[model samples]
Target chain A: MSKAVIPGMIARKTGHIINIGSTAGKEVYPKGNVYCASKYAVDALTKGMRIDLLPHGIKVTQIAPGMAETEFRSVRFGGDGPVRHRFTKVWTRCGRRTSPNWCTM
Target chain B: MRGRRAQAVEVRGLIDGLMVVRLAERGRQVKPEDQQQQRKGTHDPQMCWLACELTASGEQEVAWSTGPHAKVAFLCPMPKLILITGATSGFGEATARRFAAEGHRVIITGRRKERLEALRSELEGMHGKVEARRSFILFTSTCATMPLCKRSFPPTGMERDRCAGEQCGPRRRAGPDPGRPSRGLGAHAGHQLKACCT
Candidate 1:
């Protein structure tokens, strides 16, 4: 998507690009290998964008959020009852303890 | 619920983060001595928080989101045309609201047409009429490749006419009008907001 609007930003010489990342990008979990890899890619991409867009006066920011109670959990679990319940308990405790710096609804 | 409170906190943080960036930008533009002098007695957390609150309340007349009013007023800036992808829910939705509340122009994109329209309506209702030409609801999926991204980037002919104006003609070249307060799409409208891969 950055590809689409970059030309115009180049012309104007100013813009801001904010990418939403995840804590999974910073650490790997037992069953979340693929998800971690994807988020790690986001981490790398944000850095690259900042470097490339710097001379153009465009600011790039990455907001890396940890697990929050959102549709993401349901989608990731695929609505499996027992497993969903188990993970929810684990996540809820972790969430309360640390209170993620960034969160999804 | 705890989840909802977390969302609210995170959303407030996101807006405050942006406000800090704007403050940093202002800092960079001014001389170091002036900034240092201006920083005297500015450590009052209560005053800073109050300034942010005033900004959140739509008091654009306050001049800036933070800092001393007299000095910051000169740096009071124009609203940016912000483009947010996956804006139907979650962080994107919250971020959209935070920025829209501050009177910035927001162009939201998502695959869910109904949800996108709903968000657009909700924001408009809160912020007053944001000219349709300046705000767009682009229905784009997460494209994986550069070629697919380039292809998906163009607005449909109907949207193009509504936004870019006739064959992507006259308006595209007109640039921004300095005299006016940016009523139409302006230079940024037609080719704005393409900052996501997913």
Candidate 2:
């Protein structure tokens, strides 16, 4: 996405790029190691893309949302299974503690 | 401690949303109207729909039991308008319910028309006044992707790249062209509204 937009950035000479990274990029969870690594890559990409495109007057940014209420829970917890139930309990109990002010979706 | 924690939570939430919008804006996937709608809190159909899903999926049962502390923890100030994608279920649905209850205009989108209709009816019944201008629902598979397609304006077959690092992340296929005009490159560049509100 960043690459495709580079042209637009160059053409505009003043563009903004916002990367939707994740908290996983900043810190790894026990079960979410790979996901975290990908996010880290995103973090790196944001910096690299920003610096590379800075000459064109483009601004780069990254957003790393954590524990947002979305389909992520269902996907992670195992869709209508016991894992779902247990994870839901843990999520409801611990989500606010870990993520603080989280939003849905 | 509790009050401080709540304040921290609120800040984080705002930051997260802002971050996403900033990222989207930087990426150029967002349109000016979309940004304006987002600022009004009526953009990002996925989030609104997720809220509705959470509400309908028996989560409302937990809302009361979660207690005042939890309420404070989860309480989000209503935006003037909200756009949600993937709103058929889960977080999107729950968000829609919450926003409507709080008297915000909401636009929802998803692949499922039935669910969207149901949600519209449900929200109207609950709010007593259907927010026609604020409430909208669309059927699109790539609804979350850039440049929302309204009923009157169909997509122009231009697929904006995915966010920076998704599975099929945007590939830099187009090389830098020195000859391209430097001004007015963005389709919606001059529009007063910026893209994707936080």
Instruction: Give the top-scoring candidate (TM-score).
Output: 1
Task: List candidate 1 stretches off by more than 4 Å.
Answer: A77-105, B1-77, B129-136, B142-198
What digit string (tens of lDDT, one per residue) describes model 1 on residues A1-105? 776656545545666788988889888888998989999999999998887777767788888776554567668867657777777688776654222213321
lDDT tens digits, residues B5-86, model 2?
1111011113223211111111122223332343433334444334333333322211111122322112233224345666
**Which residue pairs clash in candidate 1?**
none
Docking class of 1: incorrect
| Docking quality (DockQ) of candidate 1 | 0.15
- DockQ for every model, please: 0.15, 0.07
What's the lDDT for residue A7 in model 2? 46
What is the TM-score of candidate 2? 0.41
Best candidate per DockQ, number?
Answer: 1
